[model samples]
Target chain A: MARIDLDHIRHSYLRNPVKDSDFALKEVHQSFDDGAAYALLGPSGCGKTSLLNIISGLLQPSRGRLLFDGEDVTALSPEQRNIAQVFQFPVIYDTMTVYDNSAFPLRNRGFSEVDVDRRVRETLEMIDLGDRANRKARGLTADQKQKISLGRGLVRSDVNAILFDEPLTVIDPHMKWVLRSQLKQLHKRFGYTMVYVTHDQTEALTFADTVVVMYEGEIVQIGTPSELFERPSHTFVGYFIGSPGMNLLPVELDGASARLGSRVIALPGAMKSAGAAKTELGIRPEYVRLGREGLPVAIRAVEDIGRHKIVRATLEGRELAAIVPEHGEIPAEPRVTFDPKGINIYADSWRQELVA
Target chain B: MERTRNNKARFLVLPVLLLVAFSAIIPLMTVVNYSVQDTFGNNVFFWAGLDWFDELLHSPRFWQALARNLVFSGIILAIEVPLGILIALNMPKAGWGVPACLVLMALPLLIPWNVVGMIWQVFGRVDIGLLGKTLSLLGIDYNYVQDPVDARITIIVMDVWHWTSLVVLLCYAGLVSIPDAYYRAAKIDGASRWSVFRYIQLPKMHRVLLIAVLLRFMDSFMIYTEPFVVTGGGPGNETTFLSIDLVKMAVGQFDLGPAAAMSLVYFLIVMLLSWVFYTVMTNYGRES
Candidate 1:
């Protein structure tokens, strides 16, 4: 295992990329420590796969250096770097048996037959394919084939890291959950540095110790699951992570508070310099308090989704959503209030910290 | 729930069945009818009871032609399959080179078979043709019309030039359909080039290679047009395949009984060989 570091990596598919928009992956500088689980989370075309490929040495960044355990490996191939990668689709040797498929890497590296057999049997048991060791890989189901692919990665004991690029996309829902838990267990048992790339929030939040949220080819926020939920550093992160995402309202900054249209709300800290064009107050829908004595809101619709209710309302000509309990009271005249601790002040699409 | 079995929709297949009967079954029945009978003249027929089959099976000329057919097919397959795969592997994977290579590879398959034969016939003339003149200038005795070995070589080269593109095209189609992930995984696994070909490429190309082999086999086995135009079964009948010999018996000598019997035997040989090839290959695919 190794601590992988990316030093200002950037990539562009075009020959002469002068504009910032020409790059597929903009400047990214991050470090993944040894024996930690990381998830690169983003929407489609947000450079998550590109970042994963760069880490695995399948692709070289056009502009930066990559270091593995403080050794420069930017020019090395995937084999020379000792990396393993699983693709979106299952890739196994269809003509080989399950044992041979898992033992391919070991045999290719010139291991002895006894060693290859022992390692392959252990991996097959780990993947729950011990009884299918003699079966041809072509006859297996999709999930079973993917497990063989995972087994191929696990059979090698000298790999620096194992990367997965949405490997469970083709699996059924139940199998996806099962394989995910198995992967987590494997990570814990082996302590191999792993990087998983996905667009699903649940998969990212549940699988990784650090969740890196990305938007428009840039890393917007990197934090734990709860940190991402409570204090998103960017409006895009707040909008992308949760179900009924954060409610962003335009505001004008005062001395130690912010004014939304005509009403004023207490701020966590005084704004140092609010000279930006767009200033807004960001709060999650779960923190929007509904009562009878706060700012008046024109309720548009309310939807009951089993455990909770989503209250869609209009405040100052802008739509906002609030999550209310199923048994919570909705008065004839509804009013809303912002929790003091839940309010986040943004100057220009970036979060400002409290100075107290 | 049980599906409704309707008998009214069964009549929709009558038109296709009649078309097959008129086009294929009638001519086949005529051959079978003539194979077991004799005719002297004026629509007079007599039941000969397999006399023609007994005569042709014992004939040395028929056995020699069948041997020639087998050797030709074996040599063609041995040379063309590997050569086509080599050319396909060297072709560019992407960019403008793909279309350029495809067009160049498809050029030979566009020409008619007899026309290809005529081109080679002139091309092997010692006095005027480029290939023959070059061989003559190199102090080599090269006369296809006079030497049996030269005649066979010329015919084999002509067939290869005319049909190897078909194999290349089929193999190229199979090669391109392999996803890039397989190559990436192989690279990560540190596989050698030979292992990559053995484990990944050859298995992927198995189905198309079967088609190419069966096609080249049938075409070379029933070879009539090109070699007839080029060699004309000359030099003591060294190049006379089964179809050429059957045609010589039916059209040149006007022996209907034996010719019909030879045609049926030739058709059966082709059908039996094709079945053996298909069964062996598909079973191999399933087992491994």
Candidate 2:
């Protein structure tokens, strides 16, 4: 196992990248702990794949260095670094059987046939493809092929880390959950350091202990699932993580209160000085209580989402969403109150601390 | 629930049926008709009932031509397929040099076959040809017209130069269609260069390689114009292939019945060999 450390890594597809926008991956300084499972979460074109490629040594960084267990292996190839990568689309040798496909990596590294057979059989069983081991990989369905791809990565006992670039993109919805749980189980059993990259938050939240949320070629936050839900470090994380994500209202802060239009709400702590920057109060919809006396809101639409209802309304002429109980009564005119403990203040898109 | 069958879609195939009839079946039927009958003079015909076929099968000349055709096709395929694959693998994957290399490789295939023969013929003349004069200056006794071995070498070289490009082009098309992920995964798997070629490149190129082999085999087996233009099947029948001998029998000697019988036998051999090649290759694809 290896602890991958990215030391100010930056990359650009262009030959001459003068501006920050020219870089596909901005300067990223992060460390993946040994044997820890992490997910690089982002939207399309946000450089998560680039960072994964860099970590796997498929593409060398245009700037800075990468270290594995403090070795400074920036110039080494993927083979030399001993990395196993599962691509977005399943890649299998069409001429080989499923058994041979799993054994290929071990054989390439000059393992004995008996050892290769034992390891391959165990890996096939782990991926639940033991019964189809003799079948040709070319005739297998997509999910089965992806399982073989995963099996190939797991067959080798000496891999430093296994990098996955949206490996579940082609899997069926039901199989995705099954394979994800299987991967979690594998990680728990083997303690292999795995870095999974994906755009789906549920996949990231479920599969990763720490999710690295990225936006516009830079990481926005690196935190646990509950941390991301409770306190998103950047505006993009607030907008990206939850299902009707956290709502932010532009507000004026004075002492221990925030004012929006004619309504004033109490803050948990006092603001120092409302500097000449964009200020907003962020709160999750789950924390918003629909009651009789607070800031008045015009209810636009109410959606029944099985467990709870998402109430879309206009507060101070800005769109806001509140989660209410499914059996909660709705007055003709609803007034919403923010839970003081859940209020987070932001200045210029960065989360700020309030002084008590 | 069972759905009703649509019988009206059968008429949509009428055009294709008529086109195949005019293009393939009619010509093939004419050959069959000529193979089974004998003609003396002025449209007077007699049913030979395999008499010409028996005569041609017993003739040693027919067997010799058939052997020569097989040897030539075998040699061409043996030389072209591996050389073409090597050249395609070494080709630049991307850059300004890609189009340049592709255009250069395609130059030989663009030339007319007989014109290529004429060019080689002139180039090999002792008096005025650069190659012949240069070889003479090097003290090598290389005369294609008088020597049987030299004539065979010259024809084989000409065939290689004229047709290796087709194999290269087909293999190159197959090579480029493979996605980059395969290479990346191969690298991560620590695969050797030979392993990558054996597992990834060769399997992907199998379909195109089959096409290349089939085209080369059929064309070289019935080859006529190039060797005809260069050597004219001369030097005591040293370079006389099946097509050249067929012309000699039908046109020079006016032996139509034996020539038609020989032609049918040649077509059958080609069809049988091609079917064998196709079945072996596709079965390999499936069983793997």
Q: Chain B TM-score per candidate, please.
A: 0.97, 0.93
List the global CA lDDT of all models: 0.91, 0.91
What is every candidate's C-alpha DockQ against the true complex, given to 2 decimals? 0.79, 0.74
Model 2, residue A64: what's the lDDT? 92
lDDT of 2 by residue, B220-258 (tens): 998999999989997889999999999999899987777
Candidate 2 residues lying further than 4 Å off, grouped into runs, are A261-265, B1-15
Name the candidate that leads on TM-score: 1
Tens-digit lDDT track for model 1 on B24-90?
9999999999889888768899998899999999999999999999999999999999999989888
Q: What CA root-mean-square deviation does each model show from the true structure?
A: 2.1, 2.5
Model 2: how far is A172 from its true place, Å?
A: 1.2
Q: Which parts of model 1 are misplaced by more than 4 Å?
A: A255-266, A354-356, B1-6
Collision pairs in model 2: none
